[model samples]
Target: MTSQSESTEPSSALHDEQAPVKRVRVAAWAADPLTLNGLTQALMGRLDVFVAAGELPADVDVLVVAADRVTSEVMVSMRRAAAQCSAPMVLVTNELDRTRLLGAVECRVVAVLHRSAATEERLISTIDVVAGGGGLLPPNLLGDLLRQVQNLQEEVLTPRGLNTSGLTSREVDVIRLLAEGCDTEEIATRMCYSERTVKNVIYAMTSRFNLRNRPQLVAYAMRTGII
Candidate 1:
């Protein structure tokens, strides 16, 4: 057998280097320049080594936004960014309301950070995880969101003997029309059915689902996405 030295090639004078070809794409929407700059700087630095090593491609990976502005206008902008890029939105905000945060969640925001967060580690972890099709939220906010959903389920729904899962199409339509101020006559007219037919449909729906009344049916339809 050959000696170990004979089996190995001599070292080259120049090192063969590889650069990252793909990276986690991210879009950030924040309310302030300072916040935007801090976030961008942190992300860039943290991803630098991976970027340089060809693990990330320029087209497939990027920081799509570093906005120095935020408004209701930015909501549209953020949604457009999320849509066009097919990447998650990260909102860095000073105060995040549960109501608006739900809207953000609907638009596919997978990560959120406070403007005052001192480091990007959490944010970076969120980005990486979301890029890999996972989700993350701040502990307090996640709990609050869960509570909000639970409260809606328990208070507005459970007390009325309605669950979100048990609504049907005709029942949903009737309830939506009810919520829109349509009386029985108007609902029958709008649905192209006779008043008696509409009443019969509603009656059958209530009996089949064991719903108490129109109000309960309306609340159930809205909660369950049946309407």
Candidate 2:
């Protein structure tokens, strides 16, 4: 079943109710000019929102996209928006394809609003959340996202003997220290372990990942974002 727009929005009760202290820069876009104009106009009416004109500005804080449904073009627009300014986006649409929803998310869409529920109030509220580094999704797509995450954990991470970080906790400690220019003895001392344990951790990671030496290991960690 589908979720109501208001029902699926994240609860705002936890947010401070005080007046907004700063203006948020927003850019609205749509495949249709009328829809884009409407969204831009609605946001322009708010005292705390500065709707951007023409191309999205470099300092835009949020991007609002109105579409009839999620499409490849919409995903491209989302990517362009991310590349242009790195603003979190809100997708107001009639339908979002579950298969491509994660792709949109990777492009930085932080909220989803059903077109039917894209009221001025709802749009403003979602912009507030997105601007504050929060995210929301419809219940149906939320389930899909969770399922994909679970599948990744079960199918890929488990077989590799790793967790979400792609490195075990001890491995992280060892690699982190190595990246910081610590010798094995220093790492052992800092972690309160014997020097042999530190060597073992380094040996295990190198042997497992086919890295040749400590410098290579550190490089691997840095390249893969493990450190």
Candidate 3:
């Protein structure tokens, strides 16, 4: 009996060590108190998430902004909040256009969900993904985003010989895969390159463009029509 108890204790400890960490610290902001309160209630309890109050905390994993519309004023507020911390933002808004979407990208918003479609499950899942360093957008918004990038490239960058989206053809390929959710090893395997090469490509892009991280790189590619 003593030997069995000792063996079980080690196994239990290993299980504890292997358990996934689910706690995510979140901060929410909105022009309307009702919207903010609704989002707060939706995110309460599940996935071990904790929603905090006041200005965005530096340690927060995600920032959720509930807006009836994506106006210039809203964008300014978002930019201010983003300046305080580097947390990814999930914007729930009623409308998005090329201009506003570009503004949101500039503010480092990785996810956008329409007010009508912002179900509790979807909101929670989006927070989880953005917290884990991923980007999310509705399919229609994604199409519009790509179109906006193309228009900018053709009209602005191409005439100035700055077309290559500030990246070489090979670099574009790597970033495209990254936007498609490929990790370093997966990208290397798909592109027939070494893991170090993949890392170098990403490093060069971020360093050259002064981007914050991979998600920012992907957003840059989208804004430039490189992906």
Candidate models: Cα lDDT each: 0.63, 0.83, 0.83
What lDDT tens digits, residue by residue, belong to model 3 across residues 135-165? 8998888888888888888998777655545
Output the lDDT of residue 207, model 3.
95
For model 3, where is the 10-residue window of minimal lDDT?
A: 47-56
CA deviation > 4 Å runs, candidate 3:
1-22, 47-54, 163-227
Q: What digit string (tens of lDDT, one per residue) describes model 2 on residues 10-108?
A: 568756467757788887778787887788788887733444445677777888888898888878877777777778888899988888877887878
Q: Using TM-score as the measure, which candidate wins?
A: 2
Candidates in descending TM-score order: 2, 3, 1
Cα lDDT tens digits, model 1, 27-108, are 4434456655666677776554222111223344323333333446667766665555544555666666676666666666
Looking at candidate 3, what is the lDDT of residue 212?
Answer: 90
Scored by Cα lDDT, where does model 3 land? 0.83
What is residue 219's positional error in candidate 1, in angstroms? 30
